[model samples]
Target: MIVHDTPLNSYYASTSWIINITIRKDNWALTKTIQSLSFCTIPNDGFFEGIELIVTSSTTPSNGDKVVIHYYGRLAAKQGWRFDSTYDHKDQNGEPLPFEFVLGSGKVISGIESAVRSMKVGGIRRVVIPPSQGYQNTSQQPIPPNFFDRQRLFTTIFNPTRLANGEGSTLIFDIELVSLRRRRKL
Candidate 1:
């Protein structure tokens, strides 16, 4: 088989979509890979948040703490293209999916919860998640060398760009904790 890597940015730069996601922090074994990127250009203003998780920050979110977050994500590498916003999604009934959960509650994917637990409130980061902590055997990855079936990948609700099987896929997330308040121990 020929192993050829194509430039996804140059090819899938035209399509656009809006999406938002919430991620909770917890303990999880995440994978780091470069597969896709969210093309939702944040304003050039000072609001630009980098993809760096702060583990040493004080008062970090822990297990049993309810948290709120806002995020835009896509499959890692060439997998993340097109404008597929998860919030107030016009195509999906025009309502942004609300995300609030307790760390370590298994309410969200293990990869997401573990990633979120690594950040403090108001911190932004680009996290990469392995399939083990995510959908397990439920997700699919693109097949081989030329990884894009442009005609089908961008048009479907489930981006075809992110197709991982077997051991699972690694998901890339651009997450920011909007608010974090530990639930009162009553």
Candidate 2:
């Protein structure tokens, strides 16, 4: 665009200049989106694939309802342990127990509630819980030698299952939502 500031007079001189502008908002947004997605891709046969959701459920659970679940949790780090489980493994001496708790009741860890609330009956889901969500209170002093559960001895000798994770470690869980029911109102 050009503009003449001088009037149309023989004695008046007109000076016109050119100005160039570049608008890059769209390019900047696209670049940021691409950078973010780069961290979420999976390497499949030398090709990157987006994260996939596997769905196999019909009845979903909601907050304020009671839910029964079976879960197996393991630390994702190397030399990690199976910290918790409800799977019945005879050789492991584990008897699958149905864990029942009210949603949002705070009886269970934060991750469990978040996972359960999005789950359906008979559905299986794998979730990764960061340290912020589970066992954030690592500052609590370790249980004394006198304070121990019945299985502590067995775990000490044979397999260190149900291990206590270090503070800020990552935990991975395979949760199976068994059933859920609405709480009766008084």
Candidate 3:
């Protein structure tokens, strides 16, 4: 995404502003015009800092909204090795269950919360979370049911210190926002 301010001209009064944005992706280019400067809230690079985000949806969740998401998490240090996944979890009826959380509730890691903040229902995103925003402590939720994998995860995360300090691996999560519920007013 490239953004540049349009030169002041007779067509556009001084009171109003126009911003030209050019978005380019492999072999295709799109140009968008914003009539107001208020829309300039987007960062110059068109993305948030710290984590890489690939958005496949056009909608975003708001604060206090409840969200259901399915995720597959892997450690960057061990490429192709999955540390945890919602797909591996199932109920007694053999139905898959996604994780649920309210936005801004701090039920999940900061990276996940940040990533989910911009997602729409049925949208899938792949996020690369830095160690600082990843896991400072071991997470118990979304744990693998396999006994061997579970044991390995526990020992690796906890041994007098926390996981971030122990492994310090960058986390990559493929997340899908399954459902969303707006918060009700009191």
Lowest lDDT block of 10, candidate 3 = 37-46
Give the top-scoring candidate (TM-score): 3
lDDT (Cα, tens digit) per residue for candidate 1, span 1-186: 011122223333433222233334333334444334432222221112223543235457878888776555454434664322234222355444445677767657565676677677776666544444444332321111123533333333233454432323345566667667787889
lDDT of 3 by residue, 1-186 (tens): 111133213223444555454433234766766554221111212232322223354567888998888887776555546877876677787666689888887657777887778666766555555555655565624566788776665554453455545545566677778888899989
lDDT (Cα atoms) of all candidates against the true structure: 0.47, 0.47, 0.60
Report the lDDT tens digits of candidate 2 across residue range 54-83.
245477766689898776665644244565
Query: Measured by TM-score, how close is model 1 to the native structure?
Result: 0.49
**Candidate no. 2 TM-score:** 0.52
Segments in model 1 whose C-alpha atoms lie over 4 Å from true places: 1-50, 53-58, 82-98, 137-167
Q: Which stretches of candidate 3 lie over 4 Å from their true place?
A: 1-58, 139-151, 154-167
How well does each candidate superpose onto the true structure, as a TM-score? 0.49, 0.52, 0.61
lDDT value, candidate 2, whole model = 0.47
Cα lDDT for residue 174, candidate 3? 70
